[model samples]
Target: MGRPAIEVQGLWTQFGNQVVHKDLTLAVQRGEILGIVGGSGSGKTTLLRELIGLQPPSRGRVCILGEDIQRLSAAEQRRLSQRWGVLFQQGALFSALSVFDNIAFPLRELRTLDEASIRDLVMLKLRMVGLRPADALKMPAELSGGMVKRVGLARALALDAELLFLDEPTSGLDPVAANAFDELIGHVRDGLGLTVVMITHDLDSLATVCDRVAVLADQRFIAVAPLAEVVQLAHPFIRDFFHGERGDRVLRAAAQPASSPGGA
Candidate 1:
């Protein structure tokens, strides 16, 4: 296999005297959706920030798409950053910008496309994320929770980057909307041939969409495997997480056979 799409070696994150990650190491394969799950304060978000160069780690090497981010010059890092897209936890849309402009932001930053071309690309991305072209004129304030998430996803895809980092992508949606969003994520990943790293607390998402799940606990990743295998680990967190009533219900639902359309 080629080099991993993302690699972390002996990673450590410290704030004052508190250490969040210690000797953490991980590798994400190309074109795979890797879900990160951890309890509260397990530093899941911190790890995501570190991966995207938003937060620096006290000790460790982070290699993204084969380049070490810590070693990159500012200009080089800026260029490297364009190779991946990030969907922040809250969608992070500019309240002042319309949806059209939000998705167009990244494309416009390139400064190579004409207005007509930018508009065309923006509309294309909207359609790609299951949004109507007419909806592009609406501001973030006018959008529903699911719409906000879709807009954020559309903006993330505007660059056509090979990597996507999603921080709590389905956090605020209802069950139905969250399921639809999960389906959209799988569709987009497969359609774009993208490598996805998602930090999600949604069990249904981890069960249905993730190719593999990474469990974060006690300051590092305890296990990284397919959900089935990870749930089998003997750790207390794994037991509490997967064997709990809600977790068991979700897993049981995930394991059942899909009924055929129009079947009894």
Candidate 2:
């Protein structure tokens, strides 16, 4: 279709003698949520890190918003960072900072906006994530796991970024809370028209929020159009993940299409 918001072609990442990704290629369209799933140590996080410029890939290209990030000048890279936001595992909020401060941290660092403007923006973001104004004043440690995740989400939206990256957004929450979080992701993406790249273990989240998913296996990510197609992947890790013993029924139900009673 249109030019992709993020494109990774022939990406290869390595750690000493260990190769994490080999000839991996994928692309994320604008204003769409792309979920990445794989077993632990399958290099999902490694892929995300390289995409964000935290680590250099051994080979290949990453083009975000039409520019190769790895070849950019330092100033250009900084500018690119401002246009994107990330939520790491564990919410990664500053333990010492209040939730309000944590949310405002990015705005304070990147923008010329004054205190009043910053507060207004921060409050808006917090509210978007279903957090009350009063909740922002509390220390991050005082928040529940779900609340902390919301706060982290608020912070990621602080800059009004065009692109967002979430690493295991549902890692610590219970099933109910995780479902709620997935709904929130859907709402936020629609409300903001932002492209999302999420690395998630939660299959329900994939069915709920993702426009498409890429399964990482055998050192490459295979893009699958729908959850049903993904479920049929022949790779051991892919099959084990999509149709694993623990929750096959739920996945099957989630992937099923609704049918009418009368025959056509």
lDDT of 2 by residue, 171-213 (tens): 9899999999998988888778888899998878877677778
Predicted candidate 1 versus true structure: per-residue lDDT over 173-237, tens digit per residue:
99999999999988888888889999998989988888888999999999997887788789999
| CA displacement after TM-score superposition, residue 182 of candidate 2 (Å) | 0.3
- Residue 87 in candidate 1, Cα distance off native in Å: 0.7
* Candidate 1 RMSD to the correct structure: 4.3
lDDT of each: 0.90, 0.85
The TM-score of predicted model 1 comes to 0.95
lDDT of 2: 0.85
Question: TM-score for every candidate vs. truth?
Answer: 0.95, 0.93
Query: Could you tell me how far off, in angstroms, the CA of residue 211 lies in candidate 1 after the best superposition?
Result: 0.5
